[model samples]
Target: MLNERISAAKQIASELHAAQEAIDEVMIRIARLAGTLPAARRDTNMSAIVGQDAMAKVAQALAASGDVRQLLTDAHLALTATQKQVGLGTRMFGAGVKPPSAMFADEGSNDRGVVTALAQAS
Candidate 1:
């Protein structure tokens, strides 16, 4: 029974990690696209084609994605607690409890500066 549970714990941790990663990736991409919308609208030929509200819409998505990422991060913390409860210990998953932004900042491996850029863009 203990072995089965340990295996399950590993699987859950992997899934949670993947979920965090997917959200981060999408948020970064959306924010990048949001950053470009204004430039796209500035082209005289493109201005006629780009909706005035396009930038606002993309920014909204980026912000909402951040919220989603936060929720997932919180879930990760909760899962860590459960891991401890089940005697899997703190080292069962990640090395430490760093938030996604700081852990993956500036390396372009995660959604670190993307949120701030989104806020400033607003």
Candidate 2:
């Protein structure tokens, strides 16, 4: 049983790692696209088309990777379980943790509800 559990854990980790790798690749591509966005928006350059093309490619890549969906589902389940255990905020968007825009919004606050509301709006 222990071995089976270990094996399952390892598989989950591997799948999640591959998904993260895909996400990292997508992020890098998106970053490059973002860098080009400003210049593209300013001028009718070929880079604008290229940026859109790159974004489409990234989206395609993500869509093609089934492990990405599985990994996200796994993460959602884990987070949900964690939230239940902690008896805290909703797990819809990673509640009970530091938000990325928290620094811009406020200091010394765990207002996940607010964060969640803003995120949903976006």
Candidate 3:
């Protein structure tokens, strides 16, 4: 019985190690795909606007403005925060630390990303 228990423990450890390796592989693949996305979407015509007329120049300037950058930054932050919250909620509930409703309420009072961006702009 003792030898059987030891063998069972070894098998469990081996399975856990295999699961971790699979998780790492998935993470690496996700990172590689994310890295390629920006290059794939890059506009090749970016430099072709150099000889464009005044209206195009103005449009380009507006598009490149700090306000637009800040807006995008805020949106990214909000998305990241939402993702983190959801992940935390999942882990918390899985661990029996909190219920689903409690997790939802935890983020209800925060408009942190927009507020932070607006403050930075000022």
Candidate 4:
């Protein structure tokens, strides 16, 4: 039974790592696409206010997506570390971990409301 639990944990950790990688890839693609938008051709007239507002909302959604992706990555890292600590591997926890971003500095503690809003908007 103990062995089975350890195996399941390791599998879950692996899945999380793969998911994080996939999310990173998708985000990169999205960033590239966003960069390709014709900003110079965008209308800024009074009649374009609605379009501008929609664009602003899209930008907000993208930022929220990035925040969620970072949180998932962090969860994946934590899970991977736990799996390693459980004798699943000899590798050290967070051997090549990236530094946390200032954007996510208050993630868990202060962003519940924001996350909820994003979730509802989506």
Q: What is the TM-score of each candidate against the true structure?
A: 0.69, 0.37, 0.36, 0.51
Show model 1 residue runs off by greater than 4 Å. 45-50, 94-122
Candidate 1 lDDT, 20-74, residue by residue in tens:
8899899889978976777667754574457767777888899999999999988
9-85 in candidate 3: lDDT tens per residue?
45543554465455556556555554444444454434534434643544444444535445544553453355455
For candidate 3, which ten residues in a row score worst on lDDT?
90-99
Question: Pairs clashing in candidate 2?
Answer: none
The lDDT of each candidate is 0.71, 0.54, 0.44, 0.58
Model 2 clashes, total count: 0
Best by lDDT: 1
Which has the higher lDDT value, candidate number 1 or candidate number 2? Answer: 1
- Model 3: lDDT equals 0.44
C-alpha displacement of 84 in model 2, angstroms?
14
Best-first order by lDDT: 1, 4, 2, 3
* Per-residue lDDT value at 73 in model 3: 42
Cα lDDT tens digits, model 4, 1-122, are 66886668756756666777777787776666455443523533335354565566556766877997989967865665565566564332222443333122233436556656665676
Q: Report lDDT (Cα) of residue 52, candidate 2.
A: 71
